[model samples]
Target: MTNNMKHIQFNNVSYEQWKEEAIKALKGKPFETLFTPTTDGITLEPLYTQQTVIEKLGDQLEKQISTIRSLKATKDFSSAQQIFGETAEQFFKNIEDSLERGNQILTIDSRVLFDWDETNISRLASILENNPFKLVLQDKNDVILTVFEQIEPSSRKQVSGYILSKEPIKIDNYPNVRTISANTLPYHYEGANVVQELALSLALAAKFANNENNFAEFVNKFYVNFAVDTQFFSEIAKLRAFKILWKAFTKAYNAESNIAVPIVAETSLRSFSKLDEYVNLLRAGNEALSALIGGADVFTVHPHDVLVKPTDKSIRIARNVILVLKEESHAASVLDPSGGSYFIECLTAEYVEKAWSLFLEIEDAGGIDAYEESGKLQRILEEVTTARLKSIEARKHSLIGTNIYANPEDDFNVETNPLFVDVKRLSTPFEELRLLYKNLQPKISILTYGKLKNFKPRADFVSGYFATAGIVANQSGEIDSIADLLNWINKTDSQYIVFVATDEDTKTILPSILENKRKELIIDVAGRFKEEEKEWVEKGLNGFVFAGQNLVEKLNAIAERLKGEQQ
Candidate 1:
């Protein structure tokens, strides 16, 4: 018996009995309704017991938790981040400044920013020696590598690795200098699900492992970087699963089980929004929390406006998010803080099983490179991205300030840098629609009919709906007669008019109101009356604003018509 449960007296309830009680509580709803399926098609149950953990993992669970708990209690994790600068001078300045502001290590993308010649390289080398801070290079070419080779072996020890290079290089196999990385960002940024990310990355690592003559030596220097999203517990489980699976993968090659698999976590840029960019701070904070709780060795919280040139304020907030997680929350002091939860453990097991299956399938299909060359990988990701986009469109997935509770007047005209991935963001369509609407100052009049109980809810819905696109809605008083509604709408300079009434009341007033209404004003109805749509449209209804309809498509059409009218 576990320590916590020892003193507690509990009824001996069978799974069947518990299920019966659950069914009764559901009140005639099917038990299947409680089983939710993830994007990976794994069905998550409403409850989990000790028996939920698989036999293979059962023996190691306590041991692994204990090991991680000890590490968390004893050691302090260092804060690390990429230096954001376009030029060599900016790079050096940013790195120096970052190290001064509590960052222990500075990572550089040599290809993107620091394209240095020998003289500048020597200067950077001098700075490194004097500063005595760790330097990580995302070296794409031989420029950084060649300079490192020139340095004596003792000085060269400070160079962590050329871990971020897309193309694999032939470097001397050293235990200290890691060359292999599970380059997960490409897959992650391009909208691959967590299972896909793990599976494809491990498959690539396995392909590299097979080519190496000394598999153990190659595995030793291997590291991984993950792009964490806002799915709080899922991301936490993802990182933990990576560690567990890495040990299993190494064991297959008859290698040491204790070999370390270093992980660097970065907040995902996929979910970042151009509208109401302040909300990006919340997204970054939540993602950073997931990464830290997941036991990432190094964490980077990208500036909220990373897609554009980040301001000084955004950078400080991003860095401070990590600092707060480490210092104030004391996250680093409790390794695998989510370790013992049944939900997390179950999710971790599911990811591991699904990911391992996918890895094997990739290997069987020749390899990771061969699998990619077939274009099948891209197709799968595209399908998933499409589904996610549709979810956002249907309001199944809510992105506040972008899709749902957006401030239409929010403007950001700053130039954005091109991203490495071609993946589509959920907010792209909504932002485009919003931009179209922004060009026109739209005023909507909600013609409320009948009693307050009959029309108030729909009037409120119309007001919020128009506000999402920055349109001003005038919904003053409830009108019992058609003349009053028409007079009120006509007195104000409203470009559009919407009827908010009960179905019976709508049928009674719409026809009479349409006859007297201004022909130039665009007309729409608030609720979905699919059978009455054709009759209503013939009587001059432009469209219906109903739940479950694609808001992006509807808004875009309206914005285009409004723009045309202005033209």
Candidate 2:
């Protein structure tokens, strides 16, 4: 009885049957509305199946599967957490704590070496003698090279890792250490879409290989670092696609096609917000897991408060995120955990095709160097950034705790990094709006009209919209006529008043309210009155706050009015 198994059967549904059922469930909604288009120009279907994969891959289905399956021989990866401290002793203590906890790679910024004394240098050298490490030497190579020379020869021989630098350095003594990187975090920060990040990274590596005397050696030593965002499945596909692209890239160069290019993935800070800092933990965790599942050789989960001042607790939590995913989830036990999924396989193939095409374009434009000099890449990034920010403002793109579902009571007075001041983060505009009016305590009132059922919805909408910018708005009692509305406005000391009522009531009541309202009081309407907006503005209405309106522009205008009042 224990060994025997009972057989169970269920009705098999075809794609058409499933579509019919889905349509019935949608309750008259259009089926086409379920389709989503990403910033990279890839349209995502609501459902994917084996047939869908065949349709997408066509003749290359088997080839794509084989390429992705061979991307990683083993699923294991090193946990590399970038350590930061003000002094050498603090840095060493942090390094020790990280290593003792679960950090496998001694990740360091070369800029820190400039402050290290002989004692700390020796301590770091001793750590390198026994452990693997990665040093990021962005424009600090000459000094760091001399610092490396100070390490004992025996220690250098035992060291194993890679160095992330734009300019290659010859460290022949350290045989296991590689000194070239194709880092795409910069592009990610500048708001490049997934395809751009992938293509730029390849173009960057190709640039390094072109400059090197030994192409094969450069390919062998080269590694890539990508910023894994919270796009979940798309991010996983992006990394897998890179592996296929790497193989194709090497084959094009006649180099060894099977060599696995090491990939280091870190959580992107593009979506990190300061208002509700705790939510950043969830964002980081989502990104970290995606990085691991996507087959990163080394992964880093940046502290949730990294954009601001990261505390020791935050850093420890970041380190443990990787530890928990790798240890408890047992994700590393199987090679290519996301392999063979119909949707992901299709996505990987699309990414490979698009990224390779963009790479060829970069090459044709004289590689990354000439492309950068031409400013074409910068202009493209700017356009993408503007579009993304517009999406966020329109509430089409959600960044919980920042642009949507924001916490008005949350404080944002914490210390921030001056260096990250210029990074074009998605939440920065909303955060700035919050910061501008947080201490000002601007008074905003929603002038309710008509029945509670009609006015309540618009009143709540106006309140929540203002709350996103950290301005709490008080709602007035129901008003039946123009006299009651004018009486309420006279008693209240609000600087900004919004008319909240149904479309019909708003059309009838707003013109009268604007005509009678004081000249100093800035007025706005909750519902869209686009056809009569010009007439209303001329009658003394400031603007309109509707569902699809840009919250940034609306909030900025309010902030400017507040600033003018203070002056």
Candidate 3:
């Protein structure tokens, strides 16, 4: 609980004072109503203040007279995995620290080998049954497991571990903690269905919630985790609705549990781009803030370079980003910054209604298993995904540093295993848009084929090799036999052509293209000796390839100089 939750915390500003303040703030600017609508028909306003915010909280507090329940951490049970070995103690320490460091949920990677044996299962069962760390299990089995059989009650009658079940939930994880983890890991991957994911979450939970026999056992213990990506606010509203709807249903059940179902949010680093690694910090920060304000009980800080082998620096940066937001910005200081605004409230209401309606619709379709069988879940997710991608195409969502603020002049090399980034328009003032591409070298098209990789261009581009010049590619069609390639280059009224041959045809072809005096030509072949190939590179090419350098960037820099952007 935060002190801001107390009465008189907002300074109790009345509507009149707030409006007066707004008027003064807007005095210099011409005030045209800039309220806009989102794709979902949710309205967004330019500004928000306490006047518009405080009342919503008051009203909700007044009407919903239930104690605001919260989750607490027991011992860091997530640390003590039943597996003991040389590194087990080290893993245990890391787990404890992460839990105490405020990682509220203890999650298991579903892909691990620990699930392979009965011995491992027993070890897991013991840890889950006794310890706390808000046990989250990876449900990898195609069929969901029933709780009554796998997890028996301990003395306090507590059961822990997510019970993946195709049937209704047994809720037998009580006395300690139990949840479903309602897997949405797929959502982070492109092509995963959003509507299907949300539907599955609801349907799966409902399977347990709707069952009268074990309804108390299941609904009381089950919780879900969601993969939150760059589409910040939608995920926020979606999560909030889940709570209210689930709360509404559970309230009807009249169960004995006091804690609300936990929402463990993992920020999607999948969207970050490795081309601009530093930029990912901004991406991670906003997503973290949104998840926190959206009220996730447990949140994760995924490293920006996670797509690559996660480096220590990236992980440290990722975790520190969260710490800065929470401690420095006091982001979580407000219970729900967007909670009461007419716009956010309206959006939240819309989500609650739409999602709940979807839930009911799923129930009508028999349930999750039936929906999966009918391909209904697949179709729904595809629909949501199409709509989401369309939003990107329409430029409703701006991808800064990509489409919006790309700097063609930056001496950047694309890195392998790129980082994920979510692009949004920042509220900061940018310097005048300098067209960096204007001074870069004209794109050099590489026409190559065969066992020789098209690495010099395509790989160069991906590795952030091109710094000052353009490399256009359709390498599959660029080069075939050297003779034909040379004829094509000769026909070019264009200034230069690089016909690098990768196959046996290069033996016969390389000579013909170089022999043509009509155009400037360069060959980049390694291992096999060719006098003309070396001669052309020396005469026609401007840069060196001696040291495994990313020639794209070097050549681009040369071109940039030729174009007179930089001395």
**lDDT per model vs. reference:** 0.74, 0.83, 0.49
Q: Write the residue-wise lDDT of candidate 2 on 1-567 in tens digits.
A: 464445656787889999999999999999998899988879998989989988888888777767766767335777989888877878888998989998999778766533666677667777777888888775744455565666788667777887876667677677778788888878889889889999998999888888888777786678898988889999999999998898888887886557677888788889888878889999999998887888888987888888877789999999999899988888777677888898899899888889999999989999998998999899888888888889999888989988878878877755666545666788888888887787677888888988888778778878888889887788887788889998898878998888888888888888888887787888888878779989998998888889988999988888788777666
lDDT of 3 at 98: 50
Q: What does candidate 1's lDDT look like per residue over 1-567, in tens digits?
A: 468866889888877898999999999999999997766657778877776654436886776555444333115555666667777777777777887787765665455544678876876666654442323344555576665555556665554543565655555533355677778888876678989988987887888788778887676666777888888888988888787777678788886445666776788877887788889899999998888888877777878787767766777778788888887898787767888887888888778889999999888889998888988888888777877787788777788887777775677753565442354566777666666666676776787888898788788777767666666677757788877877876786877778889988887878877787788788888899888889879987788887778887887788777666667
Model 3 per-residue lDDT tens digits across residues 1-567: 566655654467765675567767886654444466554435566655544544445466323223222332221111111111124344345455554554434444323322335544444455445544433333334221332345554443664444332332334325445544465555335344334455557766766566546765564466676766666776666565566566656665675554466676667644555434456667777777777766666666667655445554565566666666667766466544555445455455556566667667878888866866898767765665565455443334554554234444443332333223222212111111112333343444444544445435433432222221223322335444545665666655433333444335545555555466453333343323444446645544333332234332444444554455233
User: How far in Å is the alpha carbon of 289 misplaced in model 1?
Assistant: 1.3
- Measured on C-alpha atoms, candidate 1 has an lDDT of 0.74
TM-score of each model, in listed order: 0.87, 0.94, 0.55
Residue 213 in model 3: shift from native, Å? Answer: 2.4
Q: Over the full model, what C-alpha lDDT does candidate 2 score relative to the true structure?
A: 0.83
Q: Which candidate is the best by lDDT?
A: 2
What lDDT does candidate 2 reach at residue 446? 86
Two-way lDDT contest, 1 vs 3, winner:
1
